[model samples]
Target: MSQKNSEGKRSARERLQEQRRKEESRTKRKRTLIAAVVVVAVLGAGAGIAALVAGGGSDKKKTAGPLVAPQGATGKDTVTIPVGKPDAKSTLTVYEDFRCPGCGQFELGFRDTIRDLEAKGQLKTDYHLVTLIDGNLRGSGSLNAANAAACAQDAGKFAAYHDLLFKNQPQETDDAFGKKSRLIELSGQVPGLDTPAFRKCVEDGTHDSWVKKSHEAFSKSAYHATPTVLLNGKDVYGDQKNPLTPDKLRQMVTANAKG
Candidate 1:
């Protein structure tokens, strides 16, 4: 073969190789762009899911309707449920959550004594119900139960229903009280409390706004825990060095009465 023909063949081969290299580079760029698009799509989907979970998880914080305080409710913003004679010499103030185990224990331990004192017209108790557990544990049990208890208050059966609730409280993790049916069922135990009005009140969440307001009040206060018991205005249950007991509470009330 002639030298020029050999050179032409070599030139043709080099051009073919160059074309293949360019094609490979284009293919690699396309794959990279597709992978980036897929990654962005996956990330966008994950963000959407996170937003949905956040929105659904905070049901207890949803805006409540008009505030409707229960019957005979007193104190600031009608947030207090007053028990015992108003003219009683001593006053016991309690801040509690319906689903809080500590509040249940407090009620179980000191209920009889408190009732006795109330009956004797020596003590008036102001109860402030809160829903701290619902906020902490991500459930509506505390809010629902508090609203139902307010309905009982309207029926003039607050004390009995309140004691009954603490007695029959479900496990802290269980949201049994979140069900209106469960609350209405418990109300059957209290005579004259299972009327149509009471049922409607429980189902309609009549005092939910009021309960939320009470919880807001507690949230803004200096205390952070439930079962915050006080004698008059002095913190009684928070003194770790001097724990408050049922007998001690009775003695204190008696002394206050005598004084």
Candidate 2:
């Protein structure tokens, strides 16, 4: 009886040990399955977020339009005027005085308008300045300024020099010659051009003939004002109350182009 009891006890102990081993293996398998599911969920979430970001980036690319500069003038030298579009169809002729307050106002107003229209090739203007503002500007005439301008034009940088002169004009005083020298000094600062050659040109009065011719034209024209404006070959500004409105200019430009 004692031997049978001992054999039964040993068999019961072995069965308990086997049961514990099987439970541990089952637990490990469940842990591995859970870890794999979490990893897959994280990867899937990352892919979705990346796709959304890419879509937003593509939309941003589509919404951006063409680029434009502050002053719409193509930085060219064809008209010998830096801030003008050479290809515009509606030709504008301005009889300007370098020292005239009205001329300054006209410059600011006209530049703003031309910027918008230049890109569309809708406006072309020729500045035929008269030396009327020079002598009296701080007590000197525009002859020196005109001489310098002619020089710049000969240097193939008339446009740049013209814009510079208008932009950096000094206050009216008794020293207009000083201002003239300063304007000429500035002409040397433009890039990729021969400054010494330009200086010689201005010194020699290269555009003297044209300046004289332009003065003759002004003298012969039906208008006589500091800011005498011709829209498509007819004198208009300095006579009208509303001289330089964008809407009116646009209308005139459109009509002139059509004609």
Candidate 3:
């Protein structure tokens, strides 16, 4: 009997040891799984942070438009014009807010002469667009208008389409046409355009980001007020820099050509 009791005690001890071993194994597995999850999470967070920083830096460098290799630029500089001719010695850049009344007046004053110059390839014009007001007229409509204008450029109707948009601009009221739809209609007014292609591209949000970047570039640059114009990368101001009439513009060009 003493031997049997001793045997039974030994068996009980072995069983207990087995259970403890099993418990320890389970604990180790749980710890391993938890450690693996934590490592994955940490790695994922690091990658995300790196991506955000990289994207932000790239955006600041671009300031506007997508990444473009420096092209048609003078020595030690880069020129970015998405739709215009690749090389132009003379450029006319405009900064304007869609809802600014002053800009509308400037457009009325200069559109005809600018058109003639553009056709003659004597000038390449760049538009830096902004939305001074939108919600009061139509919620975010001005922003949409600017974006659509950029799309028009992509569709090869920038100059004519630009005229159409400003010419048909609506007042601040309930009767105002919403921006996106209005742009579709305005596409038809652009001369020598494939309206269907333009309409489709605008609907797809093409050049929207470019428009935003152009606006940001203007804000970052030395330009002030709507219709701020530049000739050959030099700011044009006053009757001396920018002539008031076509004849004056022609004269200035002729004088510059002679020099």
The C-alpha lDDT values of all candidates are 0.91, 0.59, 0.60
| lDDT (tens digit, per residue) of candidate 3 on 20-81 | 99999999999999999999999999998777546532112222335322123222212234
**Model 2 lDDT vs. the true structure?**
0.59
Which lDDT tens digits does candidate 2 get at residues 181-248? Answer: 45556776666334766655445445445454555566676766777777767766754576657678
Instruction: Give candidate 2's error at residue 15 in angstroms.
Output: 99
**How does model 2 score by TM-score?**
0.57
Give the range of the ten consecutive residues with the poorest summed lDDT in model 3.
69-78
Evaluated at residue 125, the lDDT of candidate 3 is: 68
| Ten-residue stretch with the least lDDT total in model 1 | 55-64
lDDT for model 3 comes to: 0.60
Off by over 4 Å in 2: 1-87, 135-141, 174-180, 254-259
Candidates 1 and 3 compared: the better one by lDDT is 1
Task: Find the 10 residues in a row with the least total lDDT in model 2.
Answer: 62-71
Residue pairs in candidate 2 whose N, alpha carbon or C atoms collide under 3 angstroms: 80-159, 81-159, 82-159, 134-140, 134-141, 134-142, 135-140, 135-141, 138-173
The RMSD of every model to the true structure, in order and in angstroms, is 8.2, 24.7, 13.1
Query: How well does each candidate superpose onto the true structure, as a TM-score?
Result: 0.78, 0.57, 0.58
